[model samples]
Target: MNAIVTMDALTVDTGVRDLRAADHLLHTLAAELALPEDAFGCTHLVRGDRPRVALSLAFPSEPLLRTAQERLTARGYEVTPGVPDPMGRAVLYPGVSSLTGTLTIAELLSRSAIARVTVLGSPGQPAPDTELVTRDHVRPHWHDGELVLTAMPAVGGTLVPFEVPDPTPCCADH
Candidate 1:
């Protein structure tokens, strides 16, 4: 959300095995805890030795962090009191909901907490008038210490998020 900075972070491991479930759990926990606008909900992948998806929620202050930890602990999650290595993809952040539908590149930057939108395979940013078809799913990540969205050119010269909501299965046609 608002400029993902280096902050005291906590890891929430709910034993969710996949990204979709992890995202749901993150939203659920945030709602249950009444997370503040600046609070960040990130998803991490835990590989090997009990592979599963882990979540991280970082608040703007230590008091909020403590409160979240206490609440998550009360909910019976294995809450670790620190951030995981390679802070995972953000599933919940400030102004995330406003990114749905189609938005101009300028409107996207002005309206949402996302700091930058980088088009795939391009060294330059998309034009302000470029339409971004959000498709009801816009998930940005912390890149180079900034909250950035990666998009690719689509039909009609519009752009779409690099990661779609529903991806084709690896062997679906078989």
Candidate 2:
């Protein structure tokens, strides 16, 4: 079989009486998915009178998400990818969380969701004060904590926070 992905399953009974159990389940799932410790959750009505809680885990990619989903599915748990907000995509990690979102560095920084950000310099070589900026291809993990880009000698550029603009927009947005 392919490498196993994701972690484990958690369960909670239906109704408000099981809210705490549900909350703890979500929390545990988030942690297992490697979601940041600050991720939050809430309860929502899914069908007439019956309600289920939604847990939000913020992550960086699709493979990570597939892994999480597979794990839950293996344990007989149903998982669904939540709709993305105006941002256009939701977070996906090694495990599916309650709710998720894709965000830019500025947005993440502005929201104060992440504590710090770093730029990886170049694709294979080190350049003092410069970083790689890839414009054509993007990886699922590219948006994680420290964003790295592929650098071209002609561009003489560096990877800036996703929020910043390139002096020369020659590199296309990946």
The candidate that achieves the highest lDDT relative to the unseen native structure: 1
What lDDT tens digits, residue by residue, belong to model 2 across residues 59-162?
34556556766666675665555521211111222222221243343433344323234444433533343433324222222233322222234243434333
Over 4 Å off, model 1:
1-5
* Segments in model 2 whose C-alpha atoms lie over 4 Å from true places: 1-18, 36-43, 56-58, 84-111, 114-174
lDDT of 1 by residue, 41-64 (tens): 888889998999989998888898
Please report the TM-score between candidate 2 and the true structure.
Answer: 0.34
As a TM-score, model 1 comes out at: 0.91
Task: Determine which window of 10 residues in candidate 1 has minimal summed lDDT.
Answer: 1-10
All candidates' TM-scores? 0.91, 0.34
Model 2: lDDT equals 0.36
Best of the candidates, TM-score: 1
